[model samples]
Target: MFDSLNGNQLKKESVMLKKASIALMIVFLMVSVCSARVVDGVDMPETLQVGDAILVLNGVGTRTIAFVIKPYVGGLYLKNAETDAKKIMMADETMAIRLNIISSTGRGTMMNALRKGLRSSLDAMGGDFEMIRTRFDAFQEFFPEDKFEEGNFVDFAYLPGEGLKVYKNDGFVGLIEGIDFKQAFFGIWLNEPSPADSDLKTAMIAGDVSGEARAAQGQWLAKVDLEQEKKAAEAEAAALAKAAAEARAKEEAEQKRLAEEKAKAEAEAKKLAAAKPAPAKPVPAAAPAKAAAPAAATAVATMPAAANNALVAAFLVNAIKTSEQIAVQQGKPFDADAETRRILDMWSKIKAEVAK
Candidate 1:
């Protein structure tokens, strides 16, 4: 191809190619510097005009679920580029947040997400609960449609003095008046607790729309924290169980000690009783009073020694019966019945010997 061109023709062709190359470079630079960011296949403009205020795109992020479901692409537009989320939320200047619904999101689902975010935002702001609730209730009416399908645009533009204006698919929804509401509403994404997705929050703050926020590892640390909490709970439970077991063991040991003390006391009592001397048996009482005193004396004088012994034994038996009654009333630990039987047997033997 070069051989077909003459020397002059080659020079002209070379100049044309250089000019074309420079123009292409200029075009590329312009496009790079002023191009719209594409996030999750949604085009986010570099600048947004809201109520005569021009806001620049600070960043773009995609709201994802488990790193798989991409619901919407959120673009943050501010008066100036900012990396700090707190500053952005606190600033009262004109700013706008654009949400391009890339998937089917129902009105209920969107409102629920907003409610969670706003709650966190309001809590962070520490504003009046009733006032914030009132504003939030009014804000709920902004999303009157049942569902915001794919290719829908939801824009929340905050004007410093006028409050926050909402638009659904470029159609005006409603306005909620209050800087307090704005602080809480934006805090859903910029707040520390993260009402929606933390990874998306980071991306929006960083001004990058690389889809890295949707990565699986984005929530890895959260999972790690949960696992750590679970382990701590299990450890606490195990410690409680061990404490209970130890208490039971201690109780059982004390009970065993008490039982041993009781048995030892009983044994000592038995030993003391065994070592003590036995009491003498009682003598029998005299015969019945039906006999006269002189006759009793004569009978005693004429009676054999065995008969006298029987008479004493009878008296002893009568004494023992009275003592048994006293012992019963006093709750004494004495065998009164056995002692009576022994005395009776002795008397009978004495009587029988006397007759023989």
Candidate 2:
């Protein structure tokens, strides 16, 4: 009976240890699964407890909103709709939501409507602005009287009730009510002459000739004065012609003087030739006995072997000196003795061949 009691106590202790090991394994598995999962917007692991706050991603396209959780709300609330509801119940979660994008077509329609409303408002103002009136006056002043029709000036004068319309680039600017020729002249600083008023047209045409047109006519007269300049040019040309005649006369005189001098030189040359003495013909004569005697004495004096060699040496030396003198005159240097010997050898060989 005591052994049976001890065995039952050992079995109960073994079962308790097994239960503890299973509980530890289940805790480790839970931890491992929580650590492996990533919470993107929350920036925390799924291991977050029920009280831990975290962020979450929301919105579309490139935009995102981060929502923070309170102690009651956690990253686990994003797991499902039921958890989301629990998060809403537990904490106040505000989201930065974006409105829809506005398209170009919608913007264009709005801009057109704004422009139309602005134009209507401006028109309702009756153009009382001083700047607008001044601009209109400037535009009306731009159109001159010559631009109007032939009988329009008369019509404008007769119909004083009619308004004068002003335009800029063919766009309506404003109107000038009740204007006369004098008022128009005051505005534009020019008189509008009517065709029906012949006296005014004649006076205007004549006055134009007296005013700015007179200055233009004066310029024309100045141009006509250029014709008178031709007389001065002709006078200058005539003076040149007289000077040329004098120059021609002077040149002829110089030519005549040169001809006279040349003729005189030729006459003097002819006179000198006629007066010169004739050259006498040279006649061959026999050499004197004294000259022959001296040549014989020279030959006899050079007859000895040493004397002949000395004579030949002296002759060669003289020949070399002459050749060196010629070389010096030609801007060159020559070896006197060597050149003389070379020339003597060449002469000797030529003489020997001739003799053979």
Candidate 3:
């Protein structure tokens, strides 16, 4: 049939086919743009530009607490759309997870949720916990603020060789390096027995971009209980009060302990003081004695009057005894008067010497 056709017909047919192809492509593009996946009324773009790579939307879901408190719309973007959870999680390719916060989610809550989920995911995957935890802690540091407000888009974009880059809206937060970390982080959403909601995990992997799914998600997300919000606020306030009171009590207890320790130390010091011995009083030195005299007369002169008298008496007694012994040997009765006279003379001489 082609051999029978003329050149013009061939050219015309070629032009028509090209036009049809272009029209089909245009329609397809329009449908793609118009059928943007909506999660909780937020239109999630089909493609995301991360670094130098353009990523297609793999799945979309909402993070909720008890299926009522819708906090954020989570969308996974990859270089290729994949439904296989493990494959996507383990792949070291350019991918991203966009979290469009639709409610007032506290930073602490999100951080805790992420840490718990990522750790559980890594645990199930079975790998080095220290490495996982180190990276996980680093990832948590990206969010330093208190709360992710409504309309905040927090993105975790994984660059092939550059690790995971985090962004808040238009601002670049920080990066966590390593493929091991990236795998565990992605596993939080894709791992089996994941910490995320079952339905949410399914939606993220399967990516059901249907009107029904969107409508239901939006309606469910829109259901906000004012009483619940108020109660949560009151509860938060109460917790803050309790923490403050506990801190005060702890400080007071510490102060009391210090005071008691000081008092005990002082008491110990006083007891030690009382048990100590007193110092002895100083003694006065004695006066040195005078040098003795050389001669007997000089000695008698220096002596006290009573001492001199006693010495003279002792000499006189000795002389008298000697005289009596001499007389007994040679008729002492005949020499009594003579002896008395001699003794008298000697006494007089001794008295004179003592006076001198």
Error of 3 at 344 (Å): 99
**Candidate 3: residue pairs that collide:** none
List pairs with backbone clashes in candidate 1. Answer: 283-316, 284-312, 284-313, 284-314, 284-315, 284-316, 285-314, 285-315, 285-316
lDDT of 3 by residue, 1-356 (tens): 22233344445545554554555454444333324677798888776668755566778889878968998898988665578888888898989999888998888898888877777787878965676676667777777888989988988899888998999996898889888888888888788876477777788888444453343333322322333444455555455556656667887899999999999999999999999999888888878865432223332333334546677566545555555665566653535456556665655666678889
Question: For model 1, how does the per-residue alpha-carbon lDDT over 80-167 read when each residue is reduced to its tens digit?
Answer: 6689899999899898899999999888988888887777777777755566887788888777679988998989999989999999
Worst 10 residues of 1 by lDDT: 209-218
For model 3, where is the 10-residue window of minimal lDDT? 217-226
For each candidate in the order shown, give its overall lDDT on alpha carbons: 0.72, 0.36, 0.70
Q: What order do candidates take by lDDT, descending?
A: 1, 3, 2
Highest-scoring model, lDDT: 1
For model 2, residues 296-343, the per-residue Cα lDDT tens digits are: 223333332342667766765565666676667666767766675565
User: Which regions in candidate 1 have their CA more than 4 angstroms from the true location?
Assistant: 1-34, 207-356
Off by over 4 Å in 2: 1-224, 283-356
The clash count of every prediction, one per candidate, is: 9, 0, 0
Per-model TM-score on C-alpha atoms = 0.48, 0.20, 0.48
Query: Native-vs-model 3 lDDT?
Result: 0.70
